[model samples]
Target: MDPSTLLITFLFFLAALLYASVGHGGASAYLAVMALLGVTPAEMRPTALILNILVAGVGTFKYIRAGRFSWSVFWPFALTSVPMAYLGGRIHLPVRYFELLLGVALLFAALRLLIKPGGEREGLHPFALGWALGIGAVLGFVSGLIGIGGGIFLSPILIFLGWAETRQVSGIAAAFIVVNSASGLFGLLQSHPPLPAAIPFWMVAVLAGGWIGAELGSRYLTAPWIRRALGVVLVVAALRVLVV
Candidate 1:
């Protein structure tokens, strides 16, 4: 294989490891890698979603087994995101400005993560159905528009808002990523985005990375470092859009 493909695969593996540890599927990081390597837009969204499914699904299983997942916390935010993500996936936005906006948003999120305290804390925000619906719809739109699974955004939100602890956030984020990705992929079906021949290879690569990472994060990795790594990922993604 060529350098670019090989590099993408390697990074995907690493991304899965880091992301799954925190209950993500690494879609943003994958999108960044694809953009830096010049992957076409048509391919980027669907491919990211597919990969998101693999990593997030693994994370979901692992986190659930670890007793970190809470259905009560998960259902509220997820109630509306699926349809919104599908709708967002169907509409095309102008690439340059859209990506620029997304990059800025990611940069902001990274900053927030960098400053937060390390250990998981008791939830501070009151969980309201309205808040859940609002956040879900907004993130769902972003997921469809950008091909992210929305876990990156959600994990930080849950933690910063004190809605969930670190490992619990991972569990929730993993489940969110899985559903939104599936729904977004369904929305992108009109284009029949060409699955790269190497997708299966990437899947297996992510599987291994996701399993190992989720295991470590759920069982071993400290909360602070996971947030730190997530900050690095957001920075890379932002740079891919802003400078790459």
Candidate 2:
């Protein structure tokens, strides 16, 4: 690989590490990096979603093995998200619209990363089925449309609503990302978008990073500063997408 490609791969690894450490799929960061690197719009969504599946899949397994998962807290949201995400994936937007929406999504993801959620209190609230399903539908559709896994949006909302604790949220988010990314990818397959030849190399890089990060996070490590720094990068990339 050339220097630029090598650097992008390294960034993908770093994005996976940082995101999976907190139970995320790193799609938003991947999208941001691709945008900043001038990757074609057609390639960005599939690439990010593919990487998300591997990274988030690792995180899901690690978090579940660590006993951080909650079925009650996870299912209601996922029940609705999967199908909607698939539907959204099948609907391709024009290039200008895609860039605009992706820029907005990146900004939202940046905000979530920049402002870390507060420590969980002792009392955790019960998951509200109606609210979760509705929110899941919205997030799922957006995830499919924008080529993300939707975990970035889900984590904060769950935390803010007190539906799940930090560790539980991580587990739930990881699983959610896996399913959504997979569903979105399957839906995207209808069009059979061309994937980059280097995808295998990138997937391996992210898988390694995701494994290491998820191991540390599920055990007892949270890298807030790293997340915040990455959030900064996302913001710059989002602006680039919007303006340039």
Candidate 3:
């Protein structure tokens, strides 16, 4: 219909490619896109969460099949995150607050990930259920409140705590994002809020991008490329949230 809609869809495609490559679902980036177009704030969270599910679902399957997944590593964080994310999604914020928080979150993630890559070999750190649960709950709630999948927050913590190597972190983040998005979407649906009608169009774009990007990142692309692409996505997300 509208030319702008096509542009936004294209942008979503590219964002999904970059974000899914690094194990993200690109909700923050989607929110940024919606913001720039002056899409209704009330609609943004539900819409973004829906898109997050599709892309993260693809990413999760791809990474897990590539042998990057660890159920033991995933369950602890997911245990608390799912419910907490649901709780957060149920509470609605004012439009301005949502925009501000999304921008700040994107900026923080961009800066955190811009640091040099860590150890090449996977770290053999012991799984700490307590730490994972605590971190998961916090990020999940925040993700729900702000309309994200929380992978950006979780992956960095995993790397910092030496729980997983870079690629492993990507896989974990992909799975984590999928569940959180599902939970958040469930919560949002309860409110009878409207989701964008363009969802079907957007979903196809993201799924295709997610498949291609996740495949390349998991099998062909090196760690450095994934990291760089993630950085670019985060920076663009930050700018979109702030300026739009």
Instruction: Return the candidate ranking by TM-score, descending.
Output: 1, 3, 2
lDDT of 2 by residue, 1-244 (tens): 8776787899999989888887888887788787778778888889999999999999999999999889988898899999999998998876566668767976887887677577534236766799999999998998898788888778767765778767777889999999999999899988988887778889999999999989878896653543564466457556755876
Q: After superposition, how far is residue 8 of candidate 3 from its true place, in Å?
A: 1.3
**lDDT accuracy of residue 110 in candidate 3:** 71
lDDT of 3: 0.84
Local accuracy of candidate 3 as per-residue lDDT tens digits, 115-214: 6556444476777888888989998898888889999778767765778777878899999999999998898888999878787899899998888878
Candidate 1 segments whose C-alpha is farther than 4 A from its true place:
117-120
Q: Please count the clashing residue pairs in each candidate, in the order shown.
A: 1, 0, 0
Which scores greater on lDDT, model 2 or model 3? 3
Provide the overall lDDT of each model, using Cα atoms, as 2-decimal numbers: 0.85, 0.83, 0.84
Ten-residue stretch with the least lDDT total in model 2: 221-230
Clash pairs for candidate 3: none
Q: How close to the true structure is residue 145 of candidate 3, measured as C-alpha lDDT? A: 81
Ranking by lDDT: 1, 3, 2
Candidate 1 per-residue lDDT, tens place, 189-230, comes to 876778777788888899999999999978887778778877
